[model samples]
Target chain A: MKALDSFNPLAVFVYFMASAGIAMFSMDPVILLLSMLGAVTLFVIRREGRQTGTHLFSLFLFLTLTVINPLFQHNGRTVLFVLNDNPITLEALLYGADAAAMVVSVLYWFRSFSSIITSDKLLYLFGLLSPKPALMISMALRFVPLFRMQAKRTDMAQRALGKYKEDNAIDFIRMKLSVFSIMVSWALENGIITADSMAARGYGTGRRTCFSPYKFRPQDALLLGLSLMLAGAVGAAMALGGLEFAFYPTVSKISPDFLRLAAYIAYALLSFLPATIEIGDALKWQYLRSRI
Target chain B: MKPIRNEKLRRTVRYLVPFVLAPGFVALGITVFHEKRYAFISLCIAVSAVALFATGFDKKRTGSRRLVIVSVLTALSIVGRFIPIFKPVTALTVLTGMYLGAESGFLAGSLTAVLSNFYFGQGPWTPFQMLSWGLLGFLAGILAEPLKRSRVLLFIYGIIAGALYSFIMDVWTVVWYNGDFSIKLYLAALVSAIPYTVSYVVSNVVFLWVFAKPFGEKLTRMHIKYGI
Candidate 1:
């Protein structure tokens, strides 16, 4: 699992996209539960020994989503209670629970995703597909810190010139706006200089190619293949109505058969692959250390 | 005659994406997927639309100076998102559109969402945010003459931009919740989202009112001085 981050950027990107896509699209209770467990486990493993508020926040969101749905959505067979001429249905409650689970699961997956796929990896991916946008993104990213520093400098200079007044909300806004305006001018001026220098250095005179340290290794190939296979199976099963569930007028029972069970297992394995890899790697490390 | 026929075919294909393919996706999502896959379908639509717009921008012969200026504005708007209760991203994007051009505006708006999400956590909502803000800038560019002509018109456009942004986001909310688009559920979501929308509108109006002249004058000055 530690090596997961070191794999080819495409593999990691595809794996996360597949997992998150399934998490969002599928409403099956079993699939959602698996996704939540997988996501939380990966998140906890990655952020070990830290005080994580993610679980708590996810819990709060889950409760709020679950409770809020019954208020607005009143279509169901079993009536739970009535508040103001609106009957809260058991179906709506269940639907809300599933929806909440799906959301929380997706949230955790993305949390782990952000930690794994850093800007460099994303840039590599972008550079592979489109060079110009990738260049623009890198340029924009570089400018962010430069602009921040310039904004600070501009603010200090203004203060030094006896223009610092934040006596009220309006005044505070004025101060910020003035600083931002000045920074924009500074940035644009500097940008033109940079562009002129770039042209002088013959930036656009040749085909652009960026250096990337990541190479497609055999392990990356294996990971990519496995993720694609699993995602494809799940997606195909879904398209064929193998894992369909109705939650509207009435909640449908899950009848587990061959294709349905296969899809569910495939999704579970796909989501848990990272956590499983982590555990395996840790166990191997501990065994080697004890032997030594 | 043959070349003219090919040109006519090319034009039809160019218009096909937005005119035919977009609505086709919606119809297919509703009829075939039975609306259970609407969220994914709508996400695909948003992603492709953004891709189309981006490719269009890339095809234009944008100078390195213009690119760098766009990057700078993108960075500023991204940093502006950290401010509490009010963000100048939209106002700045509109100003960029009005001064620099519509394509620059769109690029800045979309790039702000994508790059800032590095800190804010990327999710399915990123595409929707990019589309909403990008369109706001694009339209601002289209209406730049009139908007720049009058303060009242600019403020009105600001309000509309804010409302339009929030309402487009609500489409995501409704799709995520119900797994499809339902008018009743959409209305419910809109009602619940009123407070956020109102604040969005207020902040946009305030940002534009305060920052418009300074930013505009500087941008216009740079356009003449630096020729970017």
Candidate 2:
């Protein structure tokens, strides 16, 4: 199995949730920086960093979020300049940048998350919690593709029947509306049929059991344990106020103490863990290939 | 088919879960996780509320056909969201609510937000989006009669839904930025969000005006014919 695939979905889910949660909740620059680095590293490693468009979009989001915070918020003391007779202070700007970093890092983490956690994995996770929602998700996912194909066919048939000319904006909207209504009626009718078929096959009649190929091996356990421990460290730091960084009226100093240093290191290790595994896995495969 | 064992119990569960638990979670987030993590905590509350709402629609009571129909509507709404400009998600959801009942409408709206986000990319904003859209459809379901009786009222309701959607989302924006709700910041967010809100209102009105008659007829026919 591939190194990334070797980890169970549950383990991966836990790791991402913990990583993204810390990134979302914490305002500390050190933690945010580590999160950004880790997320970017994973993206680069997994996708080979070829997705320029999304990178640009992320940068744009970061810039907009960073700039927008200072305009409305005027609580800071260190005055940078005045726009419209309002002092745009350094504190608000710094807070904006920090908030932007937090948002962007979380975004990156989720992007990686979407890539790693496939629908089947999500279904598996959800099935463990609640079966009905999982079934609904599966059904919805199934219908999305089916409906797309049906919509295409419906559009083609409508055009062949001379139903819509689409010569103007009004005509275009009319065509879309006609097609959508047709799909709804068609889907509702077929959905009943689908349900009848399911009923015949004994759905919702007996105890439900979910089948998944994933096994909780030693590596999965190890990964899950490591993530939980690291996340616990960060949570403890948060509870103890070791991770606090205030930026309201004035900026507070980030004095490095033992607990703060330990929390930072723990978060750094946690964030980099996935990328480290990826790198190690790549090197190991290369060594094996060379020996062969 | 087994009927709902206790209608009163189900109703209590349906109402209490979202109302009681959502605020309880927010309280927990504020006290335990601190104000800094309020957004994250609220997100948790949103997810749980959606999940609880979904679970309340038991397959035995609603039947598998209703579930399938809800899923189909959700898929359609997700696809509608992808259409260039002027999304019909709200119009479609409102119709679903008007015909299928409030629970299904809530399911379709919330599911559309989440499942579509799978393609558009999920973020901290996702749960809030789900809740907002879900609320619109739920309210539409509650006011289905008045909305159906008069075209003018339906259009006005559509406009109100758009504004309501924007209002809830502004709540998310303020909470996310400040880590707590402040009235002044919320007002600023609402003002700055006017253009987007107008667009939301327009799209809802436009789509409803265009598709309501045709789609409403189809849904009405299906409900009568198939008893779905």
Candidate 3:
């Protein structure tokens, strides 16, 4: 069962750029809420529930941001309460929540983004522009896990050599520093070897050829076209002031006009596109299994 | 025929691009424009341009060796973030700057923030982290000779780098809280972040004191050997 994530790297990249770009840039609460809902739906569909607990920090951040805004900003006319001679306004609180939603939704979108676009896909995208930075990124990504493994091995070797017998804090710090230095020296040595190998292979001598497994299929084109169209529609609406809402001074009345409604629908559709694709694939799989 | 002039151009660009041009665009975006979106886009563009230019410059001179070294250093910085309290990222970034040229150091610092954010979660703060660390690395490179000569200077720079990082991040905080930048709000934000800023300073100084010598020695050896 191929999911939307298995599409061409360009398609995934475009989809995320559009969705996350909108999620980060749009300030309207309704648009932000829809984006958040869509992002959460995708996370659920992807069965990333276990990772949700780790995001509690972001939730804390959202809450803190939301609470802190009304304290510092007293721009609205309708004062909700007075705390320590400072007025807390409804507009300020609402604005805080909206801003917090923007941050949190963008975070969630990026969470799914990183999962969907692996390092190879990222490199492929970057490689199109310049192969040098792309190569650097790929190497850096590779070295992260490699260095972690080396650090662990160094630690284990040090422990085996009875270096961990020191029960004092200073000695523990000294031991850790020594291990880190060993790791740094080892990494430097390995890097030279890699550089030599790359040179021997004539890495910078000619135009680079990209050997990616991803292929742009008809469906990928269709999906990309649809995403662009949806994004374009949303952008047009925003340009036309259909999604405009002022939070400071006073919360502006949200006029439920037809164009605004259509824009909201388009944005919701765009944001939820990944979840829809995943669910549709799951349903089709289940239906085929049942028929069999 | 124009080789000497070209060398002068390269030398000027090596200093001017990251320190002047990049921060200039970012400042223009934030101060000249009222739109937060444009400001953010400008910041991103500036950071990316600086990173790409630095790496490109390094690649032209040292080829892939500098790239590999920067990547490895960035990886180490990322891994250093996993250490619970006292993060060694600033120390390592500074060391890389002191050993590898400023361009490699800037690339390593910026790349570390961006790459580590993949695991820590990305937000608007990611670019700020990149810019702050990148600038710190750039400064370290400019001061590399003196820094390498004196441990005291290195530790002082580490403290300054930590403070500078916190200060820049607090600007982002103030802007996020209030839709626009205000000096009063920024001051308040700084005051509020005093405790965290102190911790950052302490950790940076402590880590630099501990890790600089060993890492600097190895990196110096590698730099001489590989000419990277």
Candidate 4:
């Protein structure tokens, strides 16, 4: 539910990544579509809807993508229209829909990931791989919002000075060059300070341990087992060619059709792990609250 | 004269601090992780690492106001890169050239291309990014003195520049994707590229509108200080 309350960012990350990996080789378009839908739904359900702007724009964008993609790619058997010299096919539209679904789905996965799995969780999970790489990622992610804030403050201060007035090309050029020079210095100083502060904390040294709020209880283990089962089933389905379908000629030709359907179900279930856990946590917390 | 020189060096350091460290590590991770042909990733790492290591180059005092102005311009330029109108590299290059002169433009333009990849994925285009953005900055410096007019003049220049920007990126993509000289793919790419190509232009135009005069004024103030 919250980054602070998560067992391991790695668990969630591994699940989504595995699903994405599975989705890529999915023989049945139906399976891919379900996984895509599953990812979006998870995205919607997560983050406490704090940054609603991104969510709103994401909806509009996904809709536009769905509508417009088919118009551009007119290469399919079932012609939806014959405009002048070209034919618009149902296949192309469907294909576009698929692509749109894929893109939006991926974006949704990323959004949910950022919300539920903050840097700390991610670091705790993957930090063992390499200290330098982990620190760099954490620092960069942390810097984005900070840099944006700093840039604003700097702008305001400069604007207040009334020094931002120059005439003619040569003078204008001269003025901006100096401005850039100063900004760069500010950035470097900030960076050095951050790096120094981080280093002083003994960050990447000697048997690194992370304190997790959520303990690995029985339910967590059960969830983990279920997750593994679902993942395995999904993989088995894809390898058997269960969920691959194309719309160019007609909806035809994907292998192990029954197995593919089973795989899709497993994939969908697997994608819902975070949502399920968060909701379960929310309910448990609410129940405890209600009891109290 | 010696006092002025020391002052200038300090000012230069003040300007370069952030640009050096932030993307420097990014370039390094990218260098080691994603190994591919062209040693492009290594080049990126080298450029940013070199820049970062040089942070101690200046110890002179730089006016915070001057830093503020460049910060605004740089931020706007980064936002411009996201618009997908003109190629990010081209808009960055042109902007660098127009405001910062040849040398600075070159660095800014190239750095933008490499740095912006932090948002998007980095791949074979890293070298091309350096070249394209750097060249745009170089060209901007060349054209800076004469171009003074309304938004329309800028828009026109941006469009032309956007087209040129697309040309280079497309050429590179063809090489990266191992695309043969197929008229079909070319036609598809050319037509499809309009949004991305024009985005650079539209965004740069927007950026120019918002920050141009303010940034220009600040730079001139700094130049006056540094005797550049």
Candidate 5:
């Protein structure tokens, strides 16, 4: 759990921003596969032997998205099959797979992102710009989980009172609505109390001082520099058309070039840095324990 | 009291920022530039619009309080997404808009998307969700008087908002599939997405029917009590 959290917030934020950005922007299948591998590896390491059943739904979504594209889109030269006079092409199927990989990889990255970057880190990143909205965002993040708990509490109380019998769909919805309204009023009253407390504490009364637990250490700076350099190399390659692929007219073959290969390596390394770090750390701990 | 010299500037910004932000950044980012930098730029625009609306639309004295209210509303919308199929995010955003100003509504709606995507997933489609929901909230705020007075108008607006959200998302889907927007492909995408769109409309209407009146009354009472 503390594996990725050990890094500075700035480092984690930059890594994700760069990785997710590259994953979304790059259409090259090789780059997309690399990003997906990195994301899945990091997700596994982060969960640390936990059941991976949670990602099955996203996988199902990926398969559906992948299959839907080729069916709806009839393009490319190589016809795989014809259904209802619509030609299904290999290029379209490949393109669909590529897009699905991109989406699923981005989703996996976000799954790790929410776990690594807590509300405090998010506020710390945004608070530098405007403290009020930053505070609001952090408060909103806090209240999400709080209100979920409140909803459960209300549900239990209503059930105990024999008021929330789920006999029919309409009755169940009505019961939920009543719980929601109770939560709404509770949230509103909570807001007033918070606002009064903030006002009394002289919030927003001049320059705001923020206290952050994250520090930009030398290692953090090193990680930031490394990620930026790798991202810059990949971006330069992309701009130079070294990473372009088109599938609609025909599946264009990518002749492996030195520059493109180098860019791919750099991008792969950049994405895999976090997972590599966690694995390396775990190995070191294991080695030390065995020696002792 | 000294006369504020930036009154004209503030007034111009009050309208100009949202205009430039809601359409300009998102459209250009999606249609024109396929670069990674544009994605970051669009995100910045969305965040700035939220900040501007939170601060620029209200008096300074009430700013923090408004922020608190918007935050809570955003939180509620996020939690509202957890209630299975009939999500109340749209209803809550509209309620916020009807009670608060358009800017507050937009902020609440957009922030709700951004925040909840933390749990759902973040991708290129996130900004579009923010823009669509934010615009719905903004429009609701503009028609607040009528919406407050007429339940029928509110319901109609809810229906439209639901469809609008689906339409915007379909645009994303088409663009994502084809790598460029095409009318033919878009129509096909719309046809495929019909079932999802219908569900969106039904959920919006059902949730709004259930949640709006009770939520609105509480917000009104809070507004009168705290003058926020």
Candidate 6:
């Protein structure tokens, strides 16, 4: 129960966002490796061993993705060998590595985020999220499993109708063939049901309130305060553009190191926002229970 | 509350809508999509394909109402693609795909690309944009039915689709722009598209996992009722 409530969504979101901005600022393998390692460490501590391993594997994936075109690609300076007269240069390798690093960091960040945010928390964050547009989005997110279950059921039903095959690929192909019609039908019917549900619930006419199982206790206040501080720091850094950099022509000139470092510190602090919120809430609840 | 999806009105819309599309297609081609004569042809074919699909699948318990609702949903999903501030392509397309068929998702995506490129001074990308965005939508549409109800699965799908879409576009650019087709050039091509690919893929997941079921389903329902 503690673990369930302890999962932090904002921590995951900011971690990835910072990763995005950071990826642009620096394509250094070392920087990327550091971030990846940190993310892996968090996963391990969380007992998400498999995820840690999965993200850790990104280094290899980065290699494969980068090496593909360059080994086969034929671009860069300091050509190592001519593959059928195509010059494969060191520059291309570096470029590939850089691209790979960026991609992997982003991927890892996302994986971390998804693990933390549950469907229900997402709803609470967005509110019952029921303006027609909001509701549709919420439904799509919710529909994944429902649709999958329905599809599984539909497939079984279709198989009974003699519409499926046994071979894996063949079965897939067959299912794909018949599934479209049924899926569309279901989506439409569900769309109608959902719309009716919303209208029946009296949606869109006025400001609507939402009910959430989770709420900010004293910890929420602390978390919110910390989040604001982090934001303000990063905001100040950006206003002065302390984190800007230009590395082309091998002339790497990074801006005010102090501010950049400070910004990064703030970014790192924000990554703990969700965790802080969780722990804070846990503490308050624990105290209240003890009092009771 | 208001009946957004009326069967009779949907039936009427299917026949009436495609007629006005030719000019729109042409305009989309030149001014919007910015392609040559070939773009016009492809756009025409694409529009007809959409209309035919709507009518053909109309009676399969999947009436035009669903099609129309999902199409509008798909279109709305296009919002995130255009708005970088809250760019949630995964979330948007997942919702779109969940409701609309893969074909509709493809149609919406391709149409969005074609239409949106207009803002960028529509150039050679009309057909290319159509193809690239079409594939994304097609993928979303195909996966939407099964994944509509599962945010987790939908989010994952969004990630894969985003990467695949970027890969496809990279290949296209290499083929179109890089005449030599050498390994180095290919590597360079792949490398360059990485940022766009990553951003798009991430956004797709973020959007889908976060919004698909709640907002996606609601708008779709409204469209069914409103007919727009």
Which candidate has the highest DockQ of all?
Answer: 2
- C-alpha DockQ for predicted model 4: 0.04
lDDT (Cα, 0-100) at B35 in candidate 2: 44
TM-score for each of the candidates = 0.91, 0.90, 0.86, 0.54, 0.83, 0.49
lDDT of 6: 0.53
Off by over 4 Å in 3: A49-62, A159-172, B1-39, B46-55
Fraction of true contacts kept, per model? 0.54, 0.54, 0.47, 0.00, 0.47, 0.01
DockQ value for model 3: 0.34
Error of 3 at B131 (Å): 2.3
Model 2: DockQ vs. true structure: 0.42
In the range A162-192, model 2's lDDT, one tens digit per residue, is 8667687878878877787788878888988
Instruction: Give per-residue CA lDDT, model 1, range B1-228, as digits (tens).
Output: 011232233345457668887888776555434435689788879987887677677566789999888888888888888888788889989988888899888888988998899988898899999999998999999999999999999999999998899889999988987786778878887888888888888988998998788888888888788787
* lDDT tens digits, residue span A153-222, model 3: 9998998898666788887877887887788889989998999999998987875545567777898998
Please give, for residues A1-292, the per-residue lDDT of candidate 6 as tens digits. 1342353444333344554434323334444455555454445445543664675587688787677545654444367777877787766666566556655655555444455555555545434222222333345445544656776788888878875666678787758646634655565567566666666767545544454556445544555566566666765665564544322223244544688778766766654444444456668889999998
Name the runs in model 4 displaced over 4 angstroms. Answer: A1-5, A24-27, A47-77, A119-126, A138-177, A189-229, A253-258, B1-190, B198-228
Candidate 5: list runs displaced more than 4 Å. Answer: A48-63, A145-183, B1-61
- Tell me the lDDT of model 4 at A200: 76
- A197: Cα error in model 1, Å: 1.1
Among these predictions, the greatest lDDT belongs to 1
Candidate 4, residues B100-218, lDDT tens digits: the string is 56545654555455445555534335556666666666666777876434556655666666677777677654322211233454556677788876675676575565445655665
Query: Sort by TM-score, best first: what order?
Result: 1, 2, 3, 5, 4, 6
lDDT for predicted candidate 4 compared with the true structure: 0.54
Badly placed stretches (over 4 Å) of model 1 are A48-52, A162-177, B1-35
